[model samples]
Target: MKIVIISLLAISLHLTNSQITSGIVSDFVRTNLIGYPLIHEPKTWIFDPDVALKRRKQFVDLHGDKGEKLIERLGLGIDGNYEERLAEQRKRDEGHLGGLNAHLP
Candidate 1:
């Protein structure tokens, strides 16, 4: 009975030690060898312009005027002309693609 308990405790300690070592090795490889990993969904502000612009559009749509304030506070690295840029796009659409109203009636 005592022998079995000691063996079980030893096995548990061994397993815990292996898990800790594995975690340390994994972190070392990711940090020293991998270096920053690849970008994916949700996106960050490191160097993705498309993500930043898309986030701006979504944010403005959701928050309206306050959205711009939050965007400024966050410093999303855009041209800071969301309204002007959209207006220009609309103007271009009107001139070239006949605008969004062309499909009406």
Candidate 2:
């Protein structure tokens, strides 16, 4: 019984060691040999601008005037054209394509 337990433990240790070594080797190859891993790439920021704009549009749409008022509270536009930005947001909100019936009406 003791011999069986010891054998099982030795096998488990071998497997765990192999797994750790394989993980280290794969990570090294991915970063150094295979150009780069996806998480380490720099161009991730510039890949999708429209998705970001769409998210901002959704936020302004949901919060409405209350949202604009909150932006003013944040003291972002003490002298700059806040009203112009608000108008631009309004235009964007209105221009979003809603439904198939929109074209018919």
Query: What is each predicted model's overall lDDT from 0 to 1?
Result: 0.61, 0.62
Q: Global lDDT for candidate 1?
A: 0.61
lDDT of 1 by residue, 1-91 (tens): 6865575556556766877756665665577656645532366566766887678767777766566557544443467876676666656
* Best candidate according to lDDT: 2
Candidate RMSDs in order? 15.4, 16.5
Residue-level lDDT for 19 in candidate 2: 79
| TM-score, cand. 2 | 0.22
* Pairs of colliding residues, candidate 1: none
